[model samples]
Target: MFQNRHNLSERQVEILVGNLLRYGVLFSSALVLLGGVLYLIYHGKETPNYQIFRGEPPAFRSPEGVATSALSGRRRGIIQLGLLLLIATPVARVAFSLLAFMRQRDITYIILTLIVLTGLIISFIAG
Candidate 1:
């Protein structure tokens, strides 16, 4: 029984590592994308909108002074990080289970993928 289990463990590890590679791709990509977005937001160009709001409430003209650009950028950054986490977690789980699937050559990937897809779809619809 022990012998059989170890063989299973080794195969499972390989498949799991493969799946981790997928999530690693997503996170690294998201970081790169977010970085580009931040750069554009900060230094892309000037428009009429910016000029219009230049001396408005967000520019210390209002009662509750707030720097709209800075506040919005900070909030966007936090939301992006949260999005990264939401995507990365289950991908990690699927990666872990992939190890078991490789060892057993079973239906783990199919089930894991379906679960991921379902969650993603639900998120999209609800949001």
Candidate 2:
């Protein structure tokens, strides 16, 4: 029932999406772990001052900033970048599914996926 007329099968697409999610999660975990280790190594001895509440720096607030900071070897940035990647994994899956649906000429799913994708983009921008 899942077979398609083209070379791309639904089962194959499922497998690919599964792999994409698995690898994306694993890679993000690794980044976060690495960042944590680095952070601990550098700041483990410091005591936190609970009296003051500090928000994240402006440099860690946006994707481009996170990428730049991560590339520059900032520990918090690395962690933030990992979180960003984790968030992006499902979005990537949705995008891939959209492409797959287009390939299969499944207009219904393609439209639905587009709507979902647009919503995601809007939320990201609005936030």
Give the winner by TM-score.
2
Query: Lowest lDDT 10-mer window, candidate 1?
Result: 56-65
Return the clash pairs for model 2, or none: none
Candidate 1 local Cα displacement, residue 89, angstroms: 16
Please report, as a residue range, the 10-residue window in candidate 2 with the lowest summed lDDT.
1-10
TM-score of 2: 0.92
- Candidate 2: count of backbone clashes, pairs at least 3 residues apart or interchain: 0
List, residue by residue over 21-60, the lDDT tens digit for candidate 2.
9999999999999999999999999999999999989998
Give TM-scores for every candidate, taking all chains together and pairing residue i with residue i.
0.33, 0.92
RMSD of 1: 11.9
Candidate 1 lDDT over residue span 67-92, tens digit each: 34334655344334444554556656
Model 1 stretches astray by more than 4 angstroms: 1-3, 46-127
Index of the highest-lDDT prediction: 2
lDDT of 2: 0.95
Q: Each candidate's root-mean-square deviation in Å?
A: 11.9, 2.2
